[model samples]
Target: MATTSDNQLRNPPLSDQARDRLRAAILEGELKPGDKINIERVAETFGISRTPIREALKALETEGLVQIQANRGAIVEPQVWQEIHHRYRMRSLLEGYAAELSCGKRDKKLIAALQDNWAQVKKAGQAKTVSQNSARSIAELNRSFHRMIWVGSGSMTLVRFLEALDLPQSFNDAFYKEQNARQVVCEHHGAIVDAFIEGDTAKASTLMERHVLDSVDLLASQADDHVSNLCC
Candidate 1:
C-alpha cells in the first residue's frame, strides 16, 4: 500500500487530484478506448494508494469516460462519433434557448463582461504560435464567455444541464489552436454579443445555435483522425 507524501497532504484530496489526472489522460488520448487502467500501477506512479485511484476511477465512470467491471479494472470508453454528434446537437438547442432567454434580460454589465472575456480570447488566439498554455487559456476564456450567457438566462436547470453536456477541455484545447477555427469562433462570438447588445433575441438564438453546430464537422473529422491513428 502506498502512502501519500507530506507534499500531497497540503494540496487537494489525493482522490480529486488522481481523478483530474486520470480524466486528463483519457481526454488527451494517453489512455485510448478499451485500455485497462492498471490501478496498482497508477497508484505507484502517483506515489499514493489504491484507494484514491479506485475513487478516482469511480468518479470518471459517472462522467462516462470509463466503465468499471466486476473483478476487473476500469476500461476507457469508446469515443463514439454518433454520441458526440448527438451531444453537440443537444448543446445547440439548449444553448440557443439560453441565449434567447439571456437576450431578453441583457444588461450593460453582462455585455461588458462578455466584451472583456472576448478581448482576452482574441488576444490569446492571436499568438504567433499556439502553445499548450495559450490553447488552454483560450479554451477557458471561450467557456467563460458562453457561461456568462448561460447564467444570464437565470435558469439554474439549463445551466446545470449545459455543464453536464460540455465536452472535455482537451477538445477545446485542440480546436482553438487552429488559426482558422479560432478566427471563426471569435467572429461568431462577436456577432452573438452584438445581437445581445441590440436585444435581438431571435438573432442571438440563431447565432448561438449556428455557432455551436458549426464546430461539429471539424470536431468529428478530428475524432476520426484520432481513432484512425490509434487503430494504426
Candidate 2:
C-alpha cells in the first residue's frame, strides 16, 4: 500500500501524469521488456516522490505493462510471444462475437459514425506518411471500430472488462512500433472497414480474427529482432 502526504497528493496530479509517461515509455520501447525501473530515478526525473510513482506503477501493473515484487519494485514484465498470441485469440473470439451481434443491433447512425472515424484514420495515415507514430493513430481508430461493436452488444460488464484489458498498450504497441507495421496495419484497416460496410457478419468475423492473428504472427516473428534492437 502506498501512503501519501495530504500536501503531496494535493500538490500535483503526479499519479496520472506519471502513468501516462510510463505507459508511453513502455509502448515506445524506451523501457524494454524485463527492464527494471528505478523508483528514485523516475521520481527525480518527474520531480515527484515515490508515493505517486508507486501509484502510477500500480496502474501499469493492472494493465500488464509492469510488475511489482516484494523484493524488487518495478520492472517491465517479459512478453511471451505465445501469450500474446493467446490474447489475440481471445480478442478475436470475443470481439468477433460482438461484431456479429452488432450487425443486427446497430443503428444507421452508429454505422455512419464508424465510417467517419475510419475516414479520419485514412487521412491521417496518408498525411503523416505512415510512420510508427502514424500507425498509432490507425490503431486508435481500430479500437474505436471494435469498441463500437462492444458498445452495441449491450453487455456492459463484458465491454467494461474488455476495456480493462488495455489492448492498446499491449497489442497495439507491438504492432505500431515496427517499421513495416504501419503499412501492414493500414492494409488490414481497409479490409476491416470494407467488411463492416458490407454488413456481412461472417466476413466481418473472419476478417477480424485473421487480422488479429496475422498481426500477432507478424509481431512474434520479429520479436527477437525487436528485443535485440530495442533492449539496448
Candidate 3:
C-alpha cells in the first residue's frame, strides 16, 4: 500500500482541531511565551500528521499566538511590549464605550451583582498567600464584572467584539499577581462600577480607559522584570 502525501491527508477541519488545541496550550501558558514549539513533537503528541500541525501553526501565526522565525521554526509569540501596548490601547477604547453604555442602562440589579463580585475579588486579592485557586477565582470574578458591564451595554455586537479580543488566561493570572496590580485592580474596577451606578456615563467611560491603561503599564513593568514569573 502506498502512503498518503501531506497534501492529501491534511484538511481544513483537521487543521482547525489542531489549531484549537495548540491555541489552548498557548493561551493557558502551557506552551509559555517565547518558547519554541516543536511541530514534529506536537504532531506526535496529538497523534496527527505533520501536515495538520503545520497548517495549524500557520493559522495560529495569523492569530498572533505563534510566529514563524528564520531558522527557528514556530515559536509561541512572546507578549511583546509593542503588541501589549497596541492591544491595551484598543481595549481601553472599547471598554470605555461599554462603561458609557452601561451607565445609560442604570441596571440596578446588574450594578448590585457587579459590586458583590468586585468585593469578592478584592478580598481574595488581599490574602497573604495567593494560591492557584485564589488567583483563578479572582480572575473569574474579574471576568464576571467585565462581562456584566459589557452585557449592560445592551449591544450584542459590542459584547461579541469585546469577547473576540485576545485576552490570555495566563496574562490575566500574571497581571493580577503583579505588584500593586491587585490593589489597583480592586479600586479601579470598583470605581467603574460606582460610576455606572451613579449614572455618570462620562466618568464611567473615563475610568474604564484609565483602568485599562493602568493595567497595561503594570503588566509591562512587571513583565519586563519577571516575564517567566508572571506568565506561569
| CA lDDT of each prediction against the hidden true structure | 0.81, 0.69, 0.77
Q: Identify the superior model by lDDT, candidate 2 or candidate 3.
A: 3
Q: TM-score for each prediction?
A: 0.75, 0.69, 0.74
**Candidate 3 to native Cα RMSD, angstroms:** 7.5
For model 3, state the Cα shift of residue 33 in Å: 8.8
**Lowest lDDT 10-mer window, candidate 3?**
223-232
Candidate 1 lDDT by residue in tens digits, 1-232: 9999987767879898888777756554556777778887788878999999999989988877788998766777775344556788999999999999999996889988988887787777876579888888889999999999999999999999999888667667877777877888888898998998899999999999999998777665444334312111
TM-score of 3: 0.74
Model 2 per-residue lDDT tens digits across residues 1-232 = 9888898756647897788777756654567778888888888878889899899999888877788988877788777334456667887777777767666564677778777876776566554345655667667876787788789778887597667644534447446655466566667666766766777778777776777778667765564443322122
- Candidate 3 has an lDDT of 0.77
**Judged by TM-score relative to the true structure, which candidate is superior, 1 or 3?**
1
Q: Which candidate leads the pack in TM-score?
A: 1
Candidate 1: what lDDT? Answer: 0.81
Off by over 4 Å in 1: 1-10, 79-84, 167-181, 215-232
Better of 1 and 3 by lDDT: 1
